[model samples]
Target: MNILMMTNTYLPFVGGVERSVQIFTGEYRRLGHQVLIVAPSSSQQIPSDETGVLRVPAIQHFNGTDFSVPLPIPGILNAALKQFKPDIVHSHHPFIIGDSALRISAQLKIPIVFTFHTFYERYTHYVPGDSKALKKFVIALATGYANLCDFVFAPSLSVAVELRRRGVLSHMEIIPTGIETELFLNGDRRVARKWLGINEDVFVIGCVSRLAPEKNIDFLVLSVKKFLEKRRKVCFLLIGSGPCEDKIKANLKNEIIEGKVIMPGTVTSQPLIDCYHAMDLFVFASKTETQGLVITEAMASGVPVVALRASGVAEVIDDKKNGCIVENESCEDFVSAMNWVQGWGRKNNLKRNAINTASKYTKEICAQKALTVYEGLRRKNHILRNHSESTWETAKRLIKAEMDIIKNMTRATGMAITNK
Candidate 1:
């Protein structure tokens, strides 16, 4: 099958959604399908021999982190769609690129599949005042686009539930984002620690995410401070960069936790996996995630996690089993959970369980499941289009019948009012 994948951001912009789309397009190409990616042009574009990359003009902005807002490139995109003639157009978000894909799919009369990769509502605070109104608008936009798609793919059950709550009653499928298992298998802990320049005896608690406000990194810092007030030997490692880097550094200095907190800046895959290996525990306090991909990455590296019970996080973590889940976002609760993990002396058991859980979310499994959804949509679209009677005609008749019933009810109420 020929597939066109659309996303607002792509390579050079490192995030879970971008990485997930890259993996999906890569796996689809490996399976003998022609895949084309349409993303906004960034500072640099990587050429790919396996799949085609079409970069569109977009506005680059710094919303605490780097991101691109792609403009309407329907002319170029539709021209490419005509040449490529993809069987399925899979879009990764409900923004500019995804909206473009929706319009193209309708115009071309092709099946469009959408994946809800991020929870935009959670980040409404970043938008100016009347955030509640903006959130409603975003949800309405999502509902409109999703209803037009052949099928909507949600990465987690929580996301699907939220979609329904927002009035998106379209056909939905829950498919979790996956990891590259081979890259995160068991390795020599001592070697990994040596590579990260960390001492073997220190208890290292770390987080790997963009240093942004929504991630609540400050909360993690506070939790670390609380932990240190009781115990002094623990260290914290932060492994990503964003606008909040300077603020976080300042806060760490002001709190006098500078020596305990380590910011290694941004690093690629291998170094990131190595960071996970060097850490004794992984702590993530973000509430904005639809699916915390780093949590699974850490689990795959045989490290237990401490995360808030937010969104789809529970789908991967079992509190007290793989790791501890803070039931609330309170600093005290987070510190208590971290202390509990330390007190249990069950790190080995937790690590083993986490690794076992991670095995279930490999890239191959995710790709296959997504392929199945695509096939199902294709068959459904084929059946609907090839039917003897037009679906539009059938829909019109149903609408007329409902209208007649309402009209009769109104007439009866009017007569009753006149008689009274």
Candidate 2:
């Protein structure tokens, strides 16, 4: 299959959606499919190692923003689409490149899919309007864009419900992005702790996410402050950099100075895996994730989670099983949950369960599941292509398509068994 992915961000951006798209592209290629990515030009030059990536002209760079608006050069994009003749187009966002994807899909009579990656309601501060009004507008925008797509991919059931509630009547699939489980699983904790200059006796609580107001980092700081009062041997490691860095640092000035909190800016690849290894527990305060990919990464590293109960975090964690879940957003509740879980009696069992939960969401499995959805959509489109046909003929074609799908699935399963 030939696949075209359009996104405002890719690769070097170092976010969940970017990483998810990269994983999908590579996995599709490994399965003998052709993949091409169209993304906005970054201020930084595209790395030589990146292949099959085409850049659009970027017009402005907002200092604190995760994206740049690429001038929609229709002629250039049209030429590329014409030459590729992709079987499907998968867009990562609702606006920006997604609008371009919609245009090209209409022109070429191709089916397009969009993934609902963010809970835009939580990001109202970025726009110039009342928070309530901005949130309503964001929901409307998401609903309108979802209605235009041939299919919508929701990373979690909660997101799917939200899209439906906002009037997304289009076909939707609930799919989670996969993690590179082995990368985290194989990291050497001793070496990682040594590299981070962490002492063996000190218990580390870590959080890896973009520093942003929407993430509720200030609230998390408050929770950490309360938790640290009793457990003086514990420290917090805050990873990743974002627009809220300076704000968060100022908010936690005393904690930073006292060595109770460490901000490592940003780290990637093995270094990122190493950070996960050095932590005894992972903490997440964000309620905006469509799917908490970082939570899974931490679990795959055999580190249990202690997170506020919200959004996809609830989907990935079972309270007292894989990890501890704070019952409310209150600082006192969060701190209390942390203290309760720090007892160390159930720590080993929780770690084992966390690893088991993460094993179910590997990159390979996610790719296979996504491909199945794509194939099903393509088959449906193929069966419905002859609009001039009679209703009886269409019915016959639908039955034939279903039979083909079943046969293909059975044969594939047999092949896997034989190989095993």
lDDT of all predictions = 0.78, 0.80
Candidate 2, residues 298-402, lDDT tens digits: the string is: 999998888887878888998888778887889888877777667762367888999999998898998898888889878887775654767776566445534
| Per-model TM against the reference | 0.87, 0.88
lDDT of 1 by residue, 1-420 (tens): 888898988987888888898888778888998998998887655555534889899877734347777877847876777799887889888767776776666555568888887777667766556355556556556666676667888888998898898667678888887888878975456776686666887788888999888898888877877776566667788889987899988777745454677888987766777778888888998888888999999899888889998887988899889889998889989988888787754367887998999999998999999999888877777776644657786566445534543453454345434532
Question: Model 1: clashing residue pairs?
Answer: none
TM-score of 1: 0.87
Candidate 2 residue 312 Cα shift, in angstroms, is 0.9
> Which pairs of residues have clashing backbones in candidate 2?
none
**Least well predicted 10-residue stretch by lDDT in candidate 2:** 411-420
Q: Please name the candidate that would achieve the greatest TM-score relative to the true structure.
A: 2
Q: What's model 1's overall lDDT?
A: 0.78
